[model samples]
Target: MLFLVAALLLLGVAMGSVAHAPLPVSLVAAAVIGVWLVVFTVRERHSRRHSS
Candidate 1:
């Protein structure tokens, strides 16, 4: 999870620098991170419920 966030952030920065389009790259990265976080949280909750 942390790795994914870091990778996306780095990719965003690299893209922004190369493309000179920080807004789009940053928005994409933010959306990806948000989706990832939501999925992770949901999966964690499901696993905990099943385990218990």
Candidate 2:
């Protein structure tokens, strides 16, 4: 609930900033965020598997 709202807010802010950013900067930022999400997903999966 709160987390979802916060995530949505952050996403909106990020998107807004990205829209104003230069193309190259936006691309790099997106790549970094993508990598971060991948890493976060992998870690969460690993943690869950180990916990279970």
Candidate 3:
């Protein structure tokens, strides 16, 4: 799906940026990515449940 692709692209960009960033910056970016993934998962599950 488009949303999934967009999420993956964003994740890739974040990871790439993190690779060149300082340790503290990398950590914060990692945390934000983690939270984004969690939110995406929850939304996907909720949408599926309701659609079914």
Candidate 4:
């Protein structure tokens, strides 16, 4: 999740610098990463509660 977020940020910057166009791909990538992070965090919290 962290990797995805970092990658998306980097890609967005690169695209912005090189192409100077709107970064649709980077926006989608960031959204995907954000969703994955939220879902994983929720699942981890639930698992910890049950295990304890």
Q: In candidate 3, what are the lDDT values of residues 1-52, reduced to their tens digit?
A: 9999999999899778878899998888779989999999999999999999
Quote the positional error of residue 46 for candidate 4 in Å. Answer: 0.4
Which of the two, 1 or 2, has more lDDT?
2
- For model 1, the local distance difference test gives 0.87
Give the candidate number with the greatest TM-score: 2
Give the per-residue lDDT of model 1 (tens digit) for 1-52.
9999999999898866757656787788779989999999999999999999
> Sorted by lDDT, highest first, which candidate order results?
2, 3, 1, 4
Against the correct fold, how does model 4 do in TM-score? 0.58
* Of 2 and 4, the candidate ranking higher by TM-score: 2
Q: Considering lDDT, which of the candidate structures 3 and 4 is the better prediction for this target?
A: 3
Weakest ten-residue segment in model 4 by summed lDDT = 14-23
Which pairs clash (backbone N, Cα, C closer than 3 Å) in model 1? none
**Residue pair clashes in candidate 3:** none
Write model 2 residue lDDT over 20-40, tens digit each, in one string.
999999888889989999999
Supply the TM-score for candidate 1. Answer: 0.60
Estimate candidate 4's alpha-carbon lDDT, on a 0 to 1 scale: 0.85
Question: In model 3, what is the error at residue 38, expressed in angstroms?
Answer: 0.3
1 versus 4: better TM-score goes to: 1
Error of 4 at 8 (Å): 14
lDDT of 4 by residue, 11-52 (tens): 898767656545796677679989999999999999999999
